[model samples]
Target chain A: MSSPPRDAPGAGVLRAAFAVARKELGESFRDRQTLLYTFVLPLCMYPAMFWIMVQGVLVVQGQKQARDVTVGVVATAETAEAARGQLALDEEGRGRIEVVALDPETPRDADAIAELIEGEEADALLFLPDGRSEDDPAALFFDSTSSQSETARGRVVSALEGWTEELRAEAAEARELDPEVLEPILIQTRKINPSKDDGALVLSLLLPILLVVMCVLGAFFPAVDLTAGEKERQTAETTLLLPIPRLGLHLGKIFAVCATSMIAATLNLLALGLSAGHLLGQLAGLGDGAPKVELPLGALISIAPLAALFAFFVSAVLTGVASLAASFKEGQALLGPVQMLFMLPAMATNLPGMELTATTAWIPVVNVSLAFRGLLVGSASAGPLLLCAFSLTVAALFAIWFSVRLLSSEEVSLSSETISMTRILRILRPR
Target chain B: MTDPTNTSAIRAEGLAKTFHDPQRGVVEAVKGVDLDCRKGEIFGLLGPNGAGKTTTLRMLSTILAPTAGRALIDGVDVAEDPLEVRRRLGFLSGSTGLYPRLTGRETLRYFGRLHGLEGERLEAAIARAFDAFDLHAFGDGRCEALSTGQKQRVSIARAVLHDPPVLILDEPTTGLDIMASSDMIQFIESRREAGTCVLFSTHILSEAERLCDRIGIVYDGRMLAAGSLDELRAMTGKEWLEEIFRELVQRADAGEGAA
Candidate 1:
């Protein structure tokens, strides 16, 4: 009674907006369904999903490497004895490959060794002829696809090559000839791929795309639940009738949707990063020279801005469309296509040729995805980032504007346009 | 006439609303309706479903603007300054819901803040509401976990949390049990005694007959007749309000038939 009932003016609307936002936030966090989909589920499920996949790959690789492979030597008794001695010299190779000398009673030829390999008793074959001629065969045979067979073949060939070089040196010395004359040139290949940052190509393309997809997924339920959910709960009318301007109310709901989306996105980033980092550490232990790369800090940091922008654009668009929907089910019907529309660009950004560029900087969802990729790979420049940021910000603004328009319309906000029987029948039998 | 804005707690003059669809062209929902509710009086808008009762209530509450005319709540025009009108009014409907996750206290705090009450005053207001509504026992429970009667109580409490001068309720007790309905009726009666203007709509004839100081019978977006129970009985030459309602509807139908 001491003061006027209505607010003084402009500041009141803002205060009311914050009040609405606070309620929206408080209510959403308390909702069990919202909490599950937006926080708990993403946190627990993402790490588990990553764990299963990495474990599967590691198990397969480990089994293949640890499998024992038997190798058969096809040679005369003396030659077999010499070959067995040569293989025995390398103690570390013995654990992986079991070298067996064929009986002196059996023929030591390619066909005999082939039979042994074909019979599955031996994974590969090694043969050395009795004659000391270049024409006489000394061969290593194994299946190309089998890691065990390939390793066995490699061990036998290196041993034979070593014996041959030793014999050549002895013969050259006895004849007082220069061994350099026997070798005209030395050929070696320096491998560019045998060095530098591991998992760069795969993680660069993959982590960003996964993150973008997760961000979208994280925003989905909250955006749908807040706008359409409130209508279904019949709370929209009461909220709409409040003294606060409709834009203030709409913004409050939008912020709630965005907050849930960001939380889900951040949870996913952390879960994926930790699980993936652990997986990489485990994988590094398997090979001495293997490149050990972690899902980077910069990648997660880049996704932050991209996630916020993407979540903002997506949730705003959802709010606009959801405002048109009369119920939660109807919102799903409308938002499903919008979600697919967003998904295509997110997926496309992961393709080989979908790199960030001047032209791509203007495409709404694709630009963010590509820009996110560029940020992770260190290939994006400030100009493209600005361009991407500019376009998405505009799109977000447009969506907010459209949502405000929907909120302002009396017919749109007040009516619950349920699908009537007559309307349903008309759809069933259109004229 | 005296300025309706200056005197009435709630006022509407030739208030109307029309809906438009691409295929249907134009459909009038609330057509050129006029009414008034003064302080310390309860006005009942009696009508069946789809009879524009809700549409009229919506317009008065500032949820929907009148397409043809204007309304004022506590001297503020709804169409011109809906925010001002909403500030002075408390609106409740059968379909108005409580936030399922929030407790009874939180719901009151939420609406009170929206009405610009905060800090110590808001807290004190909530404490008063708790005692007034006897919401103390169940104030801590989440709304979703509460029973139907409790939910209704919380809903009504949310409407009056801001303590607006005018209360607009659309079928507020439509789904309530006998105990809950009696409780709501008692609450409305007390509000009238406290000098608050109460305007509500209902299809229950007995409720209109028992509670309203004056009743308006609405049909097909028009007020067929409006008066006290005795006045309606005298005008329609019927003893019962139900018979009066039947007679008024039949006469309107006959008029349409002749046309």
Candidate 2:
């Protein structure tokens, strides 16, 4: 066969890099451990964990609501009558609360109230002083430590608030005034962007941080395998002897790692976003008015480039750091702290008022987080987003440069010495 | 300095390397080594452990840069143009490992692409390699599942996938069984007949004696002597290559003490 056509000088390196990436990715897909971390776990873990949590909460709440409680009334005949009328309208309904009519001459004291609860005569005691009027404050005494007492107190409070509102409206009617006069200042809320989905707002708050973390996690194992794993398996020297520049090999590993990380992040978001509506609806006990949790396709498309850039940055940094270690276990130990550097900046999205700004767009992981959040919420400006993309591109390039330089050094790449900070510093020092 | 016009496929002069150890300060791994091998020549570097044979070969392969002097591969300066030098050379060591997840054929394809071979040309080269090495039976199986001899054959196939003119093997038969070792020796001899220059380091004296056209004995990071077997035997007044090696080492040690 005749020789293959030659590529232009620059394209040759790129082609070699792509070849390396293809091999790494193909190998990773075959490894059970890498597949578990990159694809299988993300696809299953989020949905399973959310389901267990939501079911647990619903079970506990159902059990709490199923229990019954009794309350004793100690007051004058007039007040007792009024109290019984209001207590019958308990928000939990009459069957949940059994009203025990105590003697009208019963003492209104702490000892009596405590005995009512502690002796099981009632779960709580409602005490209204003699000659108490509608304006006079009444006391419901219950044990805060007892679940039954707390449940009873909750029901009684709801019933009494309803009774008080009725009394206030009656007083207003007697004075020949509108009941609206009772509440002078009523505040109303409206969304500034009415078209923005409420579910998208919730997802924006959550998905950005999750995406950042998943990206880091997705890059974690592959980076270790491609770099330190090569040394441990004794393939580093053979790979280095290939007729391509070290930069091509470094970029190839980074591309493979970036692809895995982006896939993981995307899969995790899909699982969570799809299940969120059902999980939240169960939590809120809203059957029909549950907000539909959907990832807006436009927002997702807009944020994808930033996410990919961020994944590249993360993959490059991790692969570079992992190359300093001589084995996989040591690579993991060294990278534990480095992973935190990306995590802390990603949590910038959790800050109450944090958003993409000119200054924030220049920050590395922080910019990615804020940009994702803003894009999801339909609040992102193109200027800051462009700046964020530029910043991430620079960071990714620098990471590639650093990794190429590190992998090129014979002391770091070829030596079997144990990794240490001093040694890494020495290797990084200008020759 | 290297002579661009020389037909030597492998050449080195006064190659040296030093490393820094936190406890030992500056450690000279390879003090100074000189070598020359022509096309179709089989040169063996015979040394004991820590004798700097591996380090010297590493420098010559362009895997590690020499702290002093220079080397050339097929007339290309190793340090000045390592990519071109690598393209012209094939390097293998006992420590060189294969990707366990890849099949034998995939591993060949990967290296072929790195050498700028693609499409039908790459496939044809891979097929020829498989046929030549008798690797068809297990070529589609993962390398991790292959036996020691089989992995060695695949590794050799990978090293020569691009048919480099110069070959470097460092203790290539170190972990092989007797049968595997014999197969490796036969492969090295075959390369000689193909007009490929072969440079290898080994501590096994008999293997070197059987295969090398010229042998260099290195001791404590220095080349004590280099010559054909008969020339060494005559120089040391010894019959066996082992006795000649011992005589040269003793002479070097006695020379060091007198200094």
Candidate 3:
């Protein structure tokens, strides 16, 4: 690394690097399809898709909340009408329950009730015993797989308890028995720490998943262009002869790939935010009164770094892997499973009650989701945030080093299509 | 640095490059080749494909380090300091690529800047290259849009933009039409007359015969013969270089058969 004389005739390595970099950027931007893939499509697709899904989910939720539920009534004594009246009283107490009468002689089978729950014909089923005594046993059937069914069961039980209390109070007043004898233990609950916002909770989780998809998608095109595209065009051979250092060329291209991915992630984030806000505003307008969900600027700020770092790491690693794959087609084939690997973690982040511990923070795509959740809810610890960032940076550097090493080797740079194991063995042979 | 007025532009001695395949043992690309090229001279390295001509050129340009021996460009050790050697030489080859996305003008300007040319000087160089190469007709055309010969001309322009004392061309006219080839041959002779030391490799005997002051016949990574065209003719006792080459290769093949 000694200093060389100025005014020398040959070009400097920095100049060669810039020449190559400028050319790559210009070519990439000039292609109409590339521009769309890099910027326009990401901006359009993310929000449009997310908005549709969210709105669909909210509609289903609204319907569930409003749906009326059915309960069963069984005659136990000679006063079948009186028993029906008691069931009516139960329904009235629950306020939203609709009671369906059943024959007492039918034995009120639990299997029939379970079938009703499974078929979705009933949100829940009730089995009443053939007795008027307050001590008579009763049963409720619910589908554990259905949250709505479970909730309906809970509502029915609470209404029955309310009816029993009213009846006992009336009997005590009439017979002059002590009202305190019927009292039992009561439980009450109040949330001490309210979550920041429902939207924040949902969006944060959603954003991480979006980031993982964006990172993987963002790496795709640049990796193709840098490796296979160059090879197909016969540009790689010329590139090898450049006076610039090998590492410089690799880094310059890697930087472009990282930048490409970051642009995509940013566009995706913006599109999602705008579309989500529009959907929320519409829902609130519908009288459901869902609160306006603004992307909190602080949360947005926190997400920016996480998204950028994740994208950089993904692009770097993918570019390295792409370089080794021999061709664009092979690279795509190789990355198909890799894409699945990345997407699964993102999908796992959306599973209800999934918690993020330190271990989760180190696993590539999953960690980004966990960090997003923490940042959005205003509970993100700085330690974990920094740790995830450091891990991503290290991964990116590793990828860059691997790619550089590949680019530096004569065997890799000079590789042709239809490579044979013998030829590879020949290259690997010691001189 | 050597005395600029007295020293040859390039001096290479006993250059060798060996490729060792894990399964095949060793394949030598170049073997013990020595060369001296003075200013205002065109030295040709004539050989078949895979005969180590490109490898020798790569070593001399500092793109490949010699497995054995050393080289000096104007007295700076190329193996020790390639960056220094790079600044002293201009290189072009059939495989040298043009950035297809960039216009010819932009390509030249970009490369000029890389060589630390800027402001008026850079502009002047770009303008001179365009005019001298007749690149003005399509200077604004993107490289991908240019015809193959046009791209070749642009590649040559990029190489000489900095006007180094030494020029290296590896099959620079392999795919060009006759007109383009003649233009290129003239350009190389002019560059030499302007005091640039030139070394070109080609499989075409006619090109080397017409343009080179001294020609080195390389085969199987070894220099089979080296001398001026007349000296080579006298030594081989053949009037035509093609006849001499055929005879020599036939002899080599016969020797191998006997072995």
Question: TM-score of model 1, chain A?
Answer: 0.69
lDDT of 1 by residue, B151-226 (tens): 8888888888777789999998988889989999998998988788999999999998889999999998988888
Instruction: Give the TM-scores of the predictions, in the order they appear.
Output: 0.82, 0.91, 0.80
Tell the DockQ for candidate 3. Answer: 0.26
Candidate 2 has a DockQ of 0.50
Strongest candidate by DockQ: 2
Docking quality class, candidate 2? medium
Which of the predicted structures, 1 or 3, would earn the higher DockQ when compared with the native?
A: 1
Error of 2 at A45 (Å): 2.6
Q: What is the C-alpha lDDT of each candidate?
A: 0.75, 0.84, 0.73
Chain B TM-scores, listed for every candidate in order, come to 0.94, 0.96, 0.93
Error of 1 at A400 (Å): 2.0
The lDDT of model 2 is 0.84
A248: Cα error in model 3, Å: 2.9
For residues B1-259, what per-residue lDDT tens digits would candidate 2 score against the true structure? 3365687988888889998876788989888788889888999999899999989998998888999988888888888988778877889887548899999999998888777777898999999999999999999999999999999999999998888889999999999989888889999999999889999999999989999999999998998888899988877899999998998989988884110
Clashes of each: 0, 0, 4
Report the TM-score of the second chain of model 3 against its true counterpart. 0.93
The docking category that best describes candidate 1 is: acceptable
